[model samples]
Target: MRNLHKIKLLYEKYLNRTATHEEVEELFMLLRDRNQFQHIHNIMEDEWERNDIDFSVENLSWEKVRSEWPTEQKISDVREMPIEKHAIWSLKIRKIVAVAAGVLIAGMMLWWWTKTNTKEYRTGFGETMEIVLSDGSRVLLNANSKMTWNTNWQNIQERTVQLEGEAFFEVSHQRMPVNNSSPDQKDSISLMPFQVITSDLSVNVLGTSFNVASRRQKTDVFLKSGEVLLVAKPPLPRSKNDEKKTAGPSLAKHMDSIYLTPGDHITYSGITRALERHEEKLPDEPTSWVDGFLVYENEKLETVLQELKDIYGKSFIMEDSTMLSRQVDLGLPYEDWYTVSELMSLSLEIEMEENNSEITVKKLEK
Candidate 1:
C-alpha cells in the first residue's frame, strides 16, 4: 500500500510551490484512491478558507459554474474581477475552486438524470391498469403495485422495467426494415431483450407472455407462453445475519441463468436469493383478470372477499368467520359495481348484506 503520509507531505510541498513535477505526479496517483477523495476535499476546503477568498464572490462563482456546466457555454460572472490587484484570486485557489465546481456539477447532473429518465406506473387498491408502451407492448399492472421504466424506451434496443408488484406483460415483436443497398442482404433484426426486474430476479424474454408478482419480499414469475430466462441478482431483501446494505449502485452479478419453457413458474426468495422452478399447467383463469374478470377457484370466501376489497376499495367482514374460510369458486366481472355483491351472493348461494363500507356473508339456509 502507498503510504498516506507521503501523499500528505507531497500535497503540502505542492501548496508551498516547492514540489518537483515527480512529487506532483505521485500526489495525484495517491488521490486516485477513493478513500483519499474525501481527505483531499477536506484539504481543498481548508485551503479555500485559508486564502480568504470573498464568500459572496465564491458563491456567485459556483452558481454561475453550476448553471453553465451542462451546456459547456462560458459565462462571465465567475471570471469577472474587481479593479484592486489584492482582490484577485491566486492560481492555486482558482484551480481548487474549478475542480470543486466540476465535482458539484457532476453530482447534480447524475441526480437530475436519475430523476428525469424514469417514469412510474402505479395502481391503487384493487385497481388494474393497462399501460401501452412506446414499443407497442402492453402491461397489465395489478393492484397496489408500482412499476418503473425508462421514458426514452424507443431509443434503446433492450427494454427493462422494474417491478414491486404483480404485472402481466405481452412483449412486442420487432422486425428490422429491409436494406436495399445490397441485393443479397438477409433480414437481421436482433432479438430485442426485454427484462422485468424485481428485487431478486430479472425475468428476460424476447417475445412472450408472462406474469410477475412480487409481494412480501418474494418474487414469482409465471410463463404463460413462449420462453423466459431468469437471472438472479443478490443482496436480496434483508434477513437475519445475512443482511447487507441495500443503498448502492445495483450492478447485476448474475451467478447463473435458469431457462424456462412455456408453462414454467419460478419463485425467488428476497432473503436467500435462492430460486426454485416448477412446471405448471398454465391456465387461462389466472390471467382472466386482465380481460375484466376476476376468477376464484376454490379459494376461501374470505380470500375472495379480500380480492373484492382490493378491486372496489370496500371493507369486507364475515359475521360467520368460519364461513369466510369456506371454499368459494366464482368469476366476478368488473362491470356492474352496484350489483356485484348481490350477484356474487346469489351465485354462491349465500346471503351477503352490505352496510356502507362493510360486506357481511352468511349461509343462506341459516
Candidate 2:
C-alpha cells in the first residue's frame, strides 16, 4: 500500500502550487493507481469536508469529465466510481487545473509523466536559437519562444510538439509500419503526421516547412513549402458567464479545420473569436526573422514600430502621425537598434529622437 500521509502531502503541495515537477507527477500517478483508489478518494473527501470553500460539481456533468480522460483505465475508473465520488474527483481536477495557464492539462499529465522523455527549448528576447530533434527535423526558435516535444518517439504514433511564441519549423518526413500489420505488410509504410500545437490552434503536416507565431491571444501560421492542416477552436471562456454563452456553440462553419497550401497564411484571433485566411504573395517576409533580420513588404510604419517594440522593448512616438499610416518596404538586422532607427529615418525621411525607454519621430530638418 502507498503511504497515505505522503500522498496527502503531495496533493496539498499541488493545491498550494508548491509541488515540484516530480511531486506533481507522483501525485497524479498515485491517484491513477487502482489499488489505492479507495484510500485516496476517502482522503480527498475528508479534506474537502474540512475546507470551507463552496466548491461544487453539481452543475458539471459526469460525461464531460469522462470525456477528458481518453485512456481505458481512466474511463474504467470513472465508470466504476460512485457518482458522489466523481464530485470530489472533479473538484480536485478543477483546483489542479486552475493553478496556472499554459500548463499542461491535468488529464494529459499522466501520459506525459509516463513518457518521461519530453524535452523543452526556449529563447530570450532579442535572441534566437536552433534546435535539432531526434527525427532529424530542425527548428529555428524565435525570441521569447518555447517549444517542447517528447524525445522518445519510437513507440509513439504521432510526432507532436507544443509551442508558445514563434518558431520556424523544417519538419522531416518519417514513416512507420502500420500497427497490427502482418509480416508481409511490413513493406507498407505510412507517413507519421508531425503536429505543432499552440494555445489557439494546431498545425499538422508531413515533411513540410512552416512558420508559426502565437502571442497575445493570436496565432498565425504560414505555409512555406508544403500543405498543412490547421485546426482551431475559440478561446476557452474565462468567466462563468462567458462559459454559459460560448459553451454550446461552434464559432465558425469553417473553423474546425482548414487546409493550407504553399503560401497560404492563416490567423486565428482569440480576442475577436475569429479565424481568417489570406494568401501572401511573398512568403519569405513572414519568416525573414529566422535569418536574424526583420523583413517588411508594404507594411505600415506603425506595424513596423510595434515589431521593434516587441522585439527590443523600445517604444516609439511618431510626431508626424501620418507617417504611421504610410506603408513602407524595408529590411533591418535584428541586433542593431541604432542601425534600425537610422534606416527607418532614412527610408521615411524622418528624424528619430531616442531616449532610454522611448523614441520620438519627427519630420527631418531641411
- Residue-by-residue lDDT tens digits, candidate 1, 1-366: 355667657766776668898986676566544445456556655655666633332355566545434332322433454545323433534545555553553345446555776789999865788899887889999887899987655554568899988899999986545445665665544666788988777888889998888875778887889988776665433333222212233355634456666776767885776666554333665567778887777677776776566557678666677887688778788664566777787888888777886766677884
Q: What TM-score number comes out for model 2? A: 0.63
Give the local distance difference test score of model 1. Answer: 0.68
**Cα RMSD to the true fold for all candidates:** 14.7, 12.4
At residue 155, give the lDDT of candidate 1. Answer: 53
Whole-model lDDT, candidate 2? Answer: 0.73
lDDT of 2 by residue, 84-106 (tens): 98777666666534332112333
**Model 1: how far is 64 from its true place, Å?**
27
Candidate 1, which ten residues in sequence have the lowest lDDT sum? 238-247
TM-scores for every candidate against the unseen true structure: 0.58, 0.63
How far out, in Å, is residue 106 in model 2? 10
lDDT of each prediction vs. the true structure? 0.68, 0.73
Model 2 worst lDDT window (10 residues): 98-107
lDDT of 2 at 56: 35
